[model samples]
Target: MVKEIKLLIKKRQSYIKEFWSYINWGIIVCSWAGVVIHIFRQTELKKLSNSLENVKGLKPISLTFFAYLDSLLTYLTELKKLSNSLENVKGLKPISLTFFAYLDSLLTYLLSFCCFFGTIKILRLLRINRRLSLLTLTLKKSAKQLLGFFLMFVVIFVAFNSLFYLLYHSYVRHYSSWLDTALTCFQMSSRHLSTIPDLKKIDTFIAAMSLFLFILLVVFMLTNMFVSIIVENFNIVRREPFNHENEVELIHFTIDKIRQWLSMSTRKRKIQTKTDPITEFPEKIDELMLAVDKLYGNTKR
Candidate 1:
């Protein structure tokens, strides 16, 4: 049954590979189309600007080859943002439209950045099946730990930033701007630890400490998950019976092979004898006894 399941998994994986090959080509074509559209739009804008009387002598600067690369990146980013916006529309059940819009904006920005790295990962997966397989297995084992760490890290970071903002608003009455207040608070926090102290500073310190602890906890949990997964898979792969009920079958096969080789060796030893067969039998018996003794010794050690 396990072997059948394994074969089924292999077949499914082959189907997935074929599906991804077509999907990857489609994405590549669409991405190129987006790039071409961007280039055409830019060209038309430049032409319009050049048609003006005051811009007759002002030639538009030619975009460097790298600019085309940048445009491709920008296109992918926009595609990811559009996908996230659609997700936001789907998630507008329990939340207000305004709140959903803000959530959508934040999620879209975060997902856009995530999509860039995801694109790179997908490319790698297409190029190397073994690495992708290993990564997939690792992700499956650590998914819960990874999600826990991500949520904890985000919560701690946001809480610290929010507390800092609140403290700035409460203490400082007149500042040039929010940025100035932020900079001033950061400078003050760095300058005096013992000279000037207050509850707000203590609150900020506690928040920072909580953030540090959360980060440490995340690291420890992830490391534990990674190590446990590797060890478990290694044991599963290297086990003698391959975690099946055919252990005695394998042992019997191995013993038969060993007996055949020993029989052939004994025949050769008999044919090449310079001494009495009776004497040689005792020596061979002694050798066998010594080998068994050594095996036992090693096992004990």
Candidate 2:
């Protein structure tokens, strides 16, 4: 029991040492900090804007009367101070907006990374499940081939993006810029066929041919090649013997023990048996049917 406790502590220490765990924790901390900072800044900004608007609505008072002169002077003095304060507040508007913009962008980026890294961490946690780990295993095994395919894909994609941009830059808005053209091409390959209509407006024949070629080369060909590579690697990996069954067995055992402790019955699988009638001999079909009928008749009697 002491050895078991020590081993558990060592395992936990190793888990804590993992860099991805640190990344996830860092993201959580930063995200919470960003949320708090955003709320505080937003409240302060709104208060400043509202105060400026309220102060701007205040009209100037006259100090023409002698009896009311003292009160008017004091009111005018306070108004002047408020006006000066408004000037300083006005200066902060642009700076505050810019800061808020930057903060919002930073928070968005952090959240995106948090989601991505969180998924990776979940996969790490669930790596014991072979079905869930198949994708990672396939990628690991086929990394070289996938890298090669990616290089080739990039070359082809760049060529097409360049071609599309050069050819339809003036005619199609999607191809107005190199970056837009590249995005449009990716969308096109992913079945976003919206650009085809725009291209058709330019020249129907050219648009038709471009669509056919792009679909054939990128969508069908490249996609199938990628799928084939992954599937081949998956098959190779799946055929190999697994050594993690012991861990899975242990998990099952623990679950079963818990269920027993709760006095819950374990699920029992019912085995179904089936018998198929033979019909191999076509010439003996009538005899077989007669025999079946006779058997049924005897059972009925």
Candidate 3:
């Protein structure tokens, strides 16, 4: 079994290595192809531009060619600028800097997403442990309820976000946009509470009322509902019965089996004590007699 497992793992690793090898080769080929194509295009365009500049008379054909060449150069320049903006960040134009910033932000978000899912995948391996399985089990059992709750939460959240944006967008800086308003609301819910003071400074009456409603609807109601759902599902998951062995038990069982298979167990094998054949035969006969008596004459007709 161990040999077979090792072979299977090696086979899988070979396939992964081959896949990545092909991907690397393909990237290299495509990159060189792109570089060659770009070089040829640039040289050809430069030749055309030089020839057009030396023309003595402005013929209609030359004029049209010059115009086309100018437009192409402009496009190529923009493309080169874009590539340079991503490749080299020093002394970038404003538009290029903005593009670079957006690219960085996007990469940052993607990395965060990758890390988040990677952690979840790692945690999945710990499901053999009882303590770790509870969290996953709870989520599995309460997935539907959580989804429904999240949808409802989003609806309520969006409504409040829009309200705050409309209410305080003119006066308060925090509620400037939908994103800012949502963030501000999250901060308030998380016990930051500075948004209320800022809102109150703008309009005392509106801020007081908005605070009461937000707290009642969002902070108190939604927070408690989410906690209650999780707790209820967690308790249910805990109460459910499972016969599967946990991580520690499984590990010990595996270790014992391996030790026994290798003839290395701490407890030695027991040896049977020999008895005389005459005494054993008499005992066997007595057992046979009891069996016959019980089968034939145990109950009287």
Q: Find the candidate with the highest lDDT and give its number.
A: 2
The regions of model 3 sitting more than 4 angstroms off are 1-105, 246-301
lDDT, candidate 2, equals 0.70
Ranking, lDDT, top scorer first = 2, 3, 1
- After TM-score superposition, the amount by which residue 182's alpha carbon in candidate 2 deviates from its true location, in angstroms, is 2.2
**Tens digit per residue, CA lDDT, model 3, 130-246:** 777898789878888999999998998888899899988988889888899999989977768887667777889988888888888889999999999999999998998864532
lDDT of 1 at 120: 48
Instruction: Flag regions of model 1 displaced more than 4 Å.
Output: 1-33, 36-40, 52-132, 168-301
Compared with the true structure, all predictions reach lDDT values of 0.48, 0.70, 0.66
Winning candidate number (TM-score): 2
Q: How do the predictions measure up, each by TM-score?
A: 0.33, 0.56, 0.52
Error of 2 at 51 (Å): 7.9
Q: Over all chains combined, what TM-score does candidate 3 have?
A: 0.52
Which is superior by TM-score, 1 or 2? 2
Give the Å error, residue 110, model 3. 2.6
Specify the poorest-scoring 10-residue window by lDDT in model 2. 61-70
Clashes of 2: 0
> How do the residues 1-301 of candidate 1 rate in per-residue lDDT, one tens digit apiece?
3543464477876745443444444444545554555555455445433433243333333323212323446645654553444353332233222332333344344445545544745644442333334544555455666677667656654554454456445554422346654454444334432213443454667546643453454345544655675667645434423222322343445566687887743221222325678878989999999999999999999
Q: Which ten residues in a row have the lowest lDDT in candidate 1?
A: 264-273
lDDT of 2 by residue, 1-301 (tens): 3443465477887756455556566666766876786676566556545644544444432212211222446645654654454454433343233453454456556666767766777766667887887876777789899999999999888878887898899988889999999999989988988887788788888778777887898999999999999889999989977757446443666787789899999774343544354644664787899999999999999
Name the lDDT value of residue 37 in candidate 3.
49
